[model samples]
Target: MADEEVWKAIDDLHAWLDANKAVDGPEALLLRVLKLSEEVGEVAQAVIGATGQNPRKGTSHTWDDVRSELCDVVITALVALRTLTPDAREVFATHLAGVTERSLDGRTP
Candidate 1:
C-alpha cells in the first residue's frame, strides 16, 4: 500500500482501539510487533518448505503457498509499525531513499 494509505489505516485502528478503550500505548504496539514477527517467521518457514530446505521429514510447500504467507508478513509489519509511529511516511521515505542510494552504489552495471 502507499504510505498515506498505511498512515490512514493506522489512524483508523488507533481510533477504533480508543473507542473500545483497548489502547495501551507502547505495550500494545510491542505486542503487535511480536505478533508480526511470528507471522514473518511463518513466511520464512513457507519459503524453506517451498525450496526443499525445511528438512522436517516430509515437509514441503508450493511457491504460491509461500507467496501468500510472505504477503501476510509484510501486511502485518506495516500495520504494526503504523500503530507505533504517527510518522511512518517520513520514516519510510528517509530510510528507503538512503537504502536505494546505497544499493545503487553497489550495482555491478
Candidate 2:
C-alpha cells in the first residue's frame, strides 16, 4: 500500500483504539511513545532469532520475520506520531526530508 493509505489506516485504527478505551489523553500519549520501545525490542528479538544468536534456540525466525518486526516498529511509531498530531504525514515527511538531507550530504535517501 501507499504511504497515504497506510497513514489513513493507522488513523482509523487510532480512532477505533480511542473508542474502545485503549488509549487517551496525556498518559495515553506517553504510553504510545513507550510502546515504540516494546516494538523495538521485538525487532531485536526477531533479528536474534533469525541470526540464531542464541545457542539454545537456533534459526527460529527467518529474515522475513525480522522485516515484519521492523514493520511493526514503524507502525507503532506512526501511531504514536498520530497521537501527538493530526498532521503526522506532513510532519514525518518534513522531518524525513531534513534527516535525509543532513545525513546524506544533501542527497535524497
Query: Which residue pairs collide in model 1, if any?
Result: none
Model 2 off-target regions past 4 Å? none
Q: What residue pairs clash in candidate 2, if any at all?
A: none
TM-score of each: 0.68, 0.90
Error of 1 at 26 (Å): 2.9
Q: Which whole-number lDDT from 0 to 100 does residue 65 have in model 2?
A: 92
Model 1 per-residue lDDT tens digits across residues 3-105: 5676677678656755664547777767777877799788888878878875664458788988899877766776666666777667767887888879899
* lDDT tens readout by residue for model 2, 15-79: 87677766467888788789899999989999999999988999899999999999999988888
Cα-based lDDT for every prediction:
0.73, 0.87
